[model samples]
Target chain A: MSNALSVKNLNVSYLGNVALTNVSFQVDEGALVGIIGPNGAGKSTLIKAMMGLIPSETGKVEILGKPIRKTRKEIAYVPQRNDIDWDFPIHVIDAVMIGTYPHLGLFKRPKKQEREWAYQCLERVGMQDYGKRQIGELSGGQQQRVFLARALAQNADIFFLDEPFVGVDVSSENTIMQILKELQKEGKTTLVVHHDLSKANVYFDELILLNKELIAKGEVTDVLEVNTIQKAYGNPLAFMKNEIGVKQA
Target chain B: MNFIEAIIHYEFLQKALITSVMVGIICGVIGCFIILRGMALMGDAISHAVLPGVAISYMLGINFFFGAVITGVLTAIGIGFVSQNSRLKNDTAIGILFTFAFAAGIILITFMKSSTDLYHILFGNVLAVRPSDMWVTLVIGILVIAGVYFFYKELLVTSFDPTMASAYGLSTKLVHYLLMTMLTMVTVASLQTVGIVLVVAMLITPAATAYLLTDRLWVMIYLASGFGVVASVIGLYFSFMYNLSSGATIVLVSTLLFITVFLFSPRHGFIRKVIKSRKRASLAN
Candidate 1:
């Protein structure tokens, strides 16, 4: 089977500061991979580099075994909510409909069927009532739901999401995970830049731990051992040896 | 004279009415993008900046539309350049360019000292609407509306969520350039009716008023165009009655409309709140 996404020697820079160095990873079809690291660990940069959202200095990224330049429409991207301006005049439904632009082709407005599809995507993420609400009116968690709805509306085979669960409520977080599980069941590949180590283990089928580089990759249980977790996160059982371990997350 | 006989008596008034209405339609349609992109003041800046371009074009005996379009595009490109190349903020660059261009226009107007219809340059000559000016605006207006419709979604998406648009393979840079080009055309086209000083009022006030009345972008566009037309007609009437500059009168009407909307909008206005409170008190009693 072809890889859903492949990255090699992916390094990125920002203002003369090295953000990511010598990173390599690949996602198999139907995989839910979580990339976790501390602040400034370039987890977001890896996603940006892979999605071609930010130009990479040196690296190669392929989507569905084809270069990003050629296969740009085959992938979907969900940036962190804060990455976009909430005060923009667009309503939630319109924002979700934009996900179809890549497939809609230039100068082609979304037809009635496409709009209904957007409505269904909103219903999928519990944003049905918010179809006409301006994005500025949504809460952080609700905005994340809108972003997820947008990605779902894309109907792409591979999805790249940067920090989808950040600042989300427990209920919203679980809903997002359930959505991701459904995507995996549908044979879609999802690469998420996750932060909370607690849910990272339970949520992701495969975990790619990183600290500005590819530190470890494999099954979450195998690669998330205390020592490796410490190496990747600068912590070993730091939240362990307690009854509520990973519970306060 | 009977009422119908009085209606078609004045040819200049009829010409003013026609010229100002066309200018209103073009500005209202194209100004929607300017308002959405928060580049409302850009129209004022470039309108004034075209002064030197116009004078030079006149010296060479070329079409002033060519000069206005060239200068307007150049000014917009300069702002685009600064926004991309430097850390300087967009409004700061706007302020810088706004001053330099307006000053250049003022200096040029003083130096030209030509009797070739200075009223048309400074305060707009709606009554002096020539056939060539009408033809230029009609062609350009059609082109602008068509361009906007072609990229309607792309421009809307980019204006609303630039990052999401770009991520989805839509080039926000290209959209930005297209918007700037449209604005340049709109400003140059409106020069004959609104003049440079009042162009911002024409470009921003209608949209802002319509923005207060509706949350739907499409509806806002429609309402704004209507408001612009109404304001122009009212202004033309006043200009004919009181011997005032039609452009200034139109801007004043637009300002009054803004005040009305700002003070009485149902959602956020104080008067609306007061009325709602009174009604609620009566219901409780």
Candidate 2:
């Protein structure tokens, strides 16, 4: 009952071609878990399936010990940057206000309190001054911060972010990490689909290493060892190690 | 001797003017969503697909509005089903369905005999708009505007980011279908003023021009509606004076405005980019 997330025997496919197979894991409340894998490893697919964003033939996902539909508002997800149309005609404030929309229900516009709250969320991401600017005009880093601000505005207990660091500046990465840590301190559970192997060790308390199937899952130190990484990434590490001759040294 | 004073003498001119402006506002408002979602082709597809509905309605001796709305929604759904269920892409689905419907319409028109000119439905004659046609446009115009006002944020969030929209329990799929229905309604409403061949242009051009001019979506919608009204009025004027096709004239005017914005928009236009780049080059020197 205390678990923030639980997945059992989850299987997903696209047009009968299996994308994920028998993925199972559980995370306690307030845990910072990283879902890491190689490209085409269903890293995004797994999180999406658990969140019921994609249909699964057979699976069970419990959020905060309740069915996903019942607790939908308690969960927030940020898709990959590339998944969004950056040229969309909207302002930063407009983008952030979307976070408050689900709660506003249909037929009601965002009020003054919601506007101030959206602005406060922007301030948390250091984007308060950029509120009036068009979203498309923002840099990659600033755009990611805007998404973070939106997620902050959602005020959800469980967060799912897919590659929040991809194509972003180093400072933005640091800022996102800081925000994730802050979310953890607030006892919010976060699951980030991260692709960067180098940062995995420092970024997560628990790592779910996957390559279409779960290769390893547990504490970062336990799951991100050389063997587990090699298992998930395959023989590339051997080539990388020989080429660099550094990890072996 | 003035154009407005002269036109006021004729009831047909007044009806045409009212119908054109109503179509303008509806198409303009809904067109903003179509443009923002990059569903212009969908708008085109629905517009083209409604032809058979008009013909069928003529054959049934019923109001073409109901028939057109039914056919438009059906075609939209069929397009969605094909794109989602099969390997065929969206444009391919749209192409297959709209053309088939259009061809069926052409064939059906050969069989049906009525006062409704097939030519007018194909290329609208706004001057020929009857009082009933004007009333249809009025009702549909009010419905489309009210829909946008009520569901503004849902459409905004869903169009911008469906992932986030669904995460927030907005039912992105439902929102999408709602938008398609709205598009169909707009296309059906515009059938009298722009005709099927030119309805998509009315739906896309004014909104695109507005996009080039503004960053905020509400402002874009308002500007697009303004542009739509302007184009309709001027196009009506020219069509009245020169005896040109009203639908084509309206579409052409909107296109001209879009091109002007594309070339000269201070924020995102080609000329602005050129000016900024030239300044940077001079600074480098």
Residue range A129-188, candidate 1, lDDT tens digits: 999988878888889888898888888998888898878888888888899999999999
10 residues in a row with least lDDT, candidate 2 chain A: A240-249
Clash-forming residue pairs, model 2? none
TM values, all candidates:
0.90, 0.96
| Real contacts recovered, all predictions | 0.41, 0.86
- Candidate 2 lDDT over B138-167, as tens digits, reads 988898888889998888888899888887
The DockQ value obtained for model 2 is: 0.79
DockQ of 1: 0.49
Candidate 2, residue A144: CA error in Å? 0.7
Residue B102 deviation, candidate 2, in Å?
Answer: 0.9
Worst 10 residues of 1 chain A by lDDT: A240-249
Candidate 1's residue-wise lDDT over B84-128, tens digit each? 688898878888886787678767766778645556676775666
Model 1 spans > 4 angstroms off: A137-139, A232-237, A240-249, B1-7, B115-119, B268-285
Candidate 2 Cα outliers beyond 4 Å, as residue runs: A236-249, B114-116
